[model samples]
Target: MSWSIKNWRRNQILQREGIPDYIWQKLISMRCLKGLNPDELMRLRECATLFLHDKQINGAHELEITDEMRASIALQACILILNLDLDYYRNWVEIIVYPGEFILDYDYADEFGVVHHIHRIAAGEAWSAGPVILSWQDTIHTATRSGHNVVIHEFAHKIDMLHEGANGCPELHANMSAYTWHEVFSQAYAQFCHQVDKRQETIIDPYAAESPAEFFAVLSEVFFELPLITQQHFPSVYEQLALFYRQDPAQRWR
Candidate 1:
């Protein structure tokens, strides 16, 4: 089926179910979505409905999944793909929600061929072609205007994974230049790492220094939540992200 036809069919099916007004109200309460036009808001609602239908969103550890909770998560996740489509998220079929932080067993090999195992606490995680696990506590707390959002951060990693692995570079549009992406992000990441080493209190999270992939995800959080800081600190990276996401959050807020 054509893209338009598929989308229309999805919309038709969703119209029968009908998203609750409270869901839309809760979504607009989010700072990132405050200034969206009516038309854009409608599209976002449709996309979110499609996301909820296609993905299995389950609450873990005896936590009950509320309609509000699902709507909030689905709204946030679908926002990233407003200009794109559900196909971007085809690799994942489930969104598991925990009450709080979750633990993951980490295994690694040493130079002497030794192996080690460790447990790492995480707010959210996204595996290549696997489910996305998140902490509902963190998700609700992270919806502020501050530059922190596990939903956006993990989804950004999924986007990066679309082109090979999550290496800070997702597939670019025809007009975007990969050379520019590499040059700009390389310079920005190095500088950010240097600042982190210097013990500077930076607005961008220090966790971004972990890896190139992490740098991209962390910056994506900033792009949507605190777009002004992103535009001021690394305008080129923000420009690239705006082009990729097809949204100008700073302008919307302004």
Candidate 2:
């Protein structure tokens, strides 16, 4: 429907049931929401409320999902889509939260057709047209730490999967060029991988060198957390992300 209809519905719902003071306090304490203006904050709250209405933030591993936890997760997830719309996340409906890192055991075949079973631990995962799973511990650590945010990382994958698969590129705006995104990200990813190979100290996460898709997801964490560093290190990618996400987080932090 239209923006006005969505806004009116959100307002009506918010009027009846609003965010609690304690939950808002926890969100402010996280520091990521610090520089948002009053209007932005209000919109964020509205977005978060609609998120709660649309998606299920359920706790796994017998972990009790509290209202505070729901609000906190919604606040973080909504921040990424503040300038975008809820429609961007249309495919996802469930957010599974675990107490800590979880393990997944699966089997895969090699080129020789040899079957191998492996177990891997993951902090968060976003399956195309499926749920976004996260670890509550890692999610909380993002508030105090730099260069980390599983929520943003996984959500970035969802954004990347919008057009197709998560291939380091999200659906670019009319102003953004596919050639520019490819040229910039390819060069930066190669350079970062070189630095990682040499075991040099780097500002961006070394895990970013894993693949183009992971690079995109990891840089998304840095884009929201250490905006200055991301901009300073990879100016072109930062510009593209700023254009796509439609937020100058560096300016917000400043």
Candidate 3:
């Protein structure tokens, strides 16, 4: 879409289908959204409104979707792109929400190029150029936990995939250094993996150790929900994320 056409559509959505004031207020008051100034809050609201207009959020497995549920999911999803652009989330529209954890049965190739069939439970999953599947139960509750938000985690993957394939690096801005991003995240990922391998307790989720992609996604959850922790433990990584997302969440938290 051309910039002019997109801007016009966004304006129309903002004027015609704005979220109710009460719902918007409630969403902004959430812990994950803390420290947003009035202007940032307004921009976030606009982005979220456009997000809801663009994306299709559906309930699965007999789960009924509600307006509040939709707003809740949209608000969190928009937070990732609040400082960026809604186009960051383009090419995907469906957000499937289940009542709770869902079964994921699929085949995958490991490092050895051997294919394996695996069945497991997942709270959320984001596909490249595809739908974002989430467990609604985890979505609402995990936000309150220390940097454990399923919505943010999955959506972060969506953003990461925008670059090359969610390998812990996304498309960088012109001013941002790709080399710095790689170095910082690679070191952080290695340290985090070692800690997890030793079974040490970590404020960041151990799931990050799974891969570079997961490390980026999981840390993104912490970066938004618990900025202080992210800044404290992995300062360089936090700096890189701040540059990429174009938001100073740590400063906001402070």
Please give each candidate's TM-score. 0.92, 0.91, 0.94
Off by over 4 Å in 1: 1-8, 108-118
Per-candidate clashes, comma-separated: 0, 0, 0
- Give the C-alpha lDDT of model 1: 0.87
Between candidates 1 and 3, the TM-score winner: 3
Each prediction's whole-model lDDT (CA): 0.87, 0.87, 0.89
Q: For each candidate in turn, give its C-alpha RMSD to the true structure in angstroms.
A: 2.4, 2.6, 1.8
Residue-by-residue lDDT tens digits, candidate 3, 1-254: 69999779778999998989888767777777899999988998888888999899999999999888899998899999998998899998999999999999999786699999979999999988899999988988974576898999999999989887778899999999888888888888888889999999987888899999999999899899899988999899989989888898999988
Q: Which digits, one per residue and each the tens of the lDDT, describe model 1 over residues 1-254?
A: 69999778877879865569967775677765767888888888888888888888898999999888888888888888988878889867999999999999988675588999968999999988898999999998985537889998998888889997789999999989999999999999999999999999887989999999999999988888888889998898999899989999889878
Q: Give the candidate number with the greatest TM-score.
A: 3
- Highest lDDT among the candidates is held by which one? 3
Candidates, ranked, TM-score: 3, 1, 2
Candidate 3: lDDT over CA atoms? 0.89
lDDT of 2 by residue, 1-254 (tens): 69999678877888866778778866865655768888999888888888888899888989999988888888888788999998888966999999999997878675599999979899998888899999999988986777798988898999898876789998988988999999999998999999999999988878898889999999988888888888988898899889888999889888
* Residues forming the 10-long window of minimal summed lDDT in candidate 1: 26-35
